[model samples]
Target: MSYDKTIAQAARTELERRRSQAQETARLNLEGFLSRCPRAVEIRRELSSNASEAARAVVSGGEVRMELEQRKARGLALREEYDRLLKSQGLTRRDIEPQYTCPKCRDTGFVEGRMCDCHRALRRSIAYRQLSTGLPLESCTFESFSLDYYRDDPAAMKQMGIIFRTCREYAENFRPNSANLLFWGATGLGKTHLSLAIANAAIEKGFGVVYGSAQKYASAFEKERFSREAGEGTAGDLKNCDLLILDDLGTEFPSAYSNAGIYDVVNDRLMSGRPTIISTNLALDGLEKRYSERFASRIVGGYAMLGFKGRDVRVQKLNR
Candidate 1:
């Protein structure tokens, strides 16, 4: 459940921002309250002094019982006066206090030296948001995916219905070590939509998901290869994310380095038992020819193949 350092840092920044906002708001509230009710200032000062006098009486170690009782009564009277002033001004103690987003952590993202649930949720949200950039995650949901596109052909419709159900179930039951999936078919057959739907579900369940076109990853891989640094970079994230959705797999600019990079990513994820969903327009044979028999074989042996059917869905939409 490790997160990217950048994402962790962003979450920390967000928590600090919330904390600062709460404190600043409380400061302004107190300033305004004191301005409106000037008497509250003297009451607050006396309340502070009364508490200090009680502490001093305790430490004096003499027969200070009478003095302590007197201080306690005075403190109570001061508090009552303060409350009356607040009531007159239509304010409460909370109105002058910091209203932290997470009262448990006081917006600090931690409690008693352990990370808080709110912090973990923030990190997951930030990770999902960063990974889902450039994706139509909001629109490509299972609810929005229509089976009507395949209605013209009963066989296509039936198969697509099953595919849709399977995809929905897969997403609902998705885990970090769930089985791999390969979506193979012609363009505009809803492969990308279903894969993104799975990604959205996984993200909602607090799993880190990395999703992008193959070309986007390929270009990143190529760029990282030529860089001076010798770190995993994009390959690490692709292989290590809780779920990886590689879309349009055969559309990348093919080169020796990019091809090998792609193979390494696919192979490494497979070897590590990490779940991946790859959507490709290439057929099994085309995949073998484009990459290598080894790459295609890895997919064949380790992945559940879902063949998308129907005419181009984009064309169908345009016609309708």
Candidate 2:
């Protein structure tokens, strides 16, 4: 499934820019080396001329084998002499050669016209950014999460403590399609914080993680009804991402269309063995009522529901 076109384009453009940068640096280095070692430069020209002459002899049905052997010996001698000169000047052959970031692909972001792993990794990061465009990511990491806010309530404090540790662990070990999570609780319980923390982890691991509130996603999906390219069909992006975190599931402007859309997404991801983290204020029965039993049933069977039990920490923070 395709993500937002702009994001994909940005990733491609960035990778291309990196590749171009590598190529330019290599070219400049080669030019400098050739200028520094005129003898090595002459050797390269002779090697090229020998290759051309050998090709002509082969096509003309002459004894190309003897010519190829002589050229190979002459080229090896040139290479050895060049190396000796470099060593005498406190340099090495490596210093004079074009240095590539990925020698297999020559920093071209591809090999044999197929996408390189580095390019795919770039796309994954861009995909994550596309989904979390509006998220306050830096502010919601494990470090930023404050247990001081819930200190007044012993139960809340304990729950928050455990939640923090769990989230930290989750983030530390997160992999692609690792585990499904359900963040079920009332509002103001830091569901979004933990969700973003997980996203931070997945991003660190080079996995494409899509994170957004259900309200925002629902609106984007609806807007796509009018414009096909409205925000990368956020649903498709969610469906295909390495990890999906949908926050405030029941808080979206509920409608038949939205409900069906949510069900379709949740079900499809589950069927494909993709990991999705759904944070909802609604309880289990509420989920059953809002969507069909099928959606809830899928969650029951597939997801690891993490029940968040804590009073409103935001209120405690304000009072303190």
Q: Tens digits of per-residue lDDT for model 1 on 198-284?
A: 988998898878888899888887777768355578888788888988999999999878899899999999999999999999999
Q: Which residue pairs in candidate 1 collide?
A: none
Clash count in backbone of candidate 1: 0
Each prediction's TM-score versus the true structure: 0.91, 0.74
Stretches > 4 Å off in candidate 1: 1-6, 35-38, 127-133, 228-230
lDDT of 2 by residue, 1-320 (tens): 25545666887788677667766766776677678879878877887887787778788876778877887788788778877866766676565455666777766778899988877777767766665667788788888888776776798778778877877887898876577888899888888888988888788777777777788788877777667764547678878877888889988998777777788888889888888999998888989898878788888988888777767867766876
Off by over 4 Å in 2: 1-8, 25-47, 50-98, 111-117, 124-132, 226-232, 292-294
What's the alpha carbon RMSD for model 1?
2.5
Clashes of each: 0, 0
lDDT of 2: 0.78
